[model samples]
Target: MLQSTEHCHIVRNSEILSGEPIIRGTRTPVRAIVEMWRIGVSPEEIPQRLPHLVLSQVFDALSYYLDHQVEINEYIEHNRIPDELIDPRVRKA
Candidate 1:
């Protein structure tokens, strides 16, 4: 499964979640990447933040996101958190 980053097992198709991509074999939403980044988690530290994911998978997801920025951006925009609703703990205070 880790052999082909092209297989990109981290992506999945689902009826719900708007069929938005996800980490393969898990409902661990891919949107977490954007959320983490927004909250200042560096790309290099993503795997450490989510220990279940391999570093390669995290990097690949970012690559995929970059490659399909239009779609990923749309997804992120649609899922944007209202500033008022963001957890103060995560706020850039």
Candidate 2:
């Protein structure tokens, strides 16, 4: 079931990524947006990469992240692929 957050564009559903907060009506997680921005992707270009999202959704996801840093950061860390799980050839230096 979908659950609404304080933000209008953000929501969570237990069936989706175990209830990770996501942009409403899409499976794209707010973390995905944050991660992209963290890696230097500009807001204007986010939708180009995540075509499913618009500028408003991208900005809202970022706003939600700011409001719930601890929660979202936990998800980020938990979802990260550990070095041991990385394939030898695919692992980053």
TM-scores across all candidates? 0.70, 0.91
**Model 1, total clashes:** 0
Q: Give the TM-score of candidate 2.
A: 0.91
Residue pairs of candidate 1 with colliding backbone atoms: none
Best by lDDT: 2
Off by over 4 Å in 2: none
Clashing pairs in 2: none
- Tell me the tens digit of each residue's lDDT in model 2 across 1-93: 889989999999999999999999998999999999999999999999989899999999999999999999999999999999889999766
User: What tens-digit string does per-residue lDDT give for candidate 1 at 14-70?
Assistant: 454757777776666656776786678988798887888876666767776767778
- Candidate 1 versus truth, CA RMSD in Å, comes to 4.3
Candidate 2, which ten residues in sequence have the lowest lDDT sum? 84-93
The numbered model that scores best in TM-score is 2
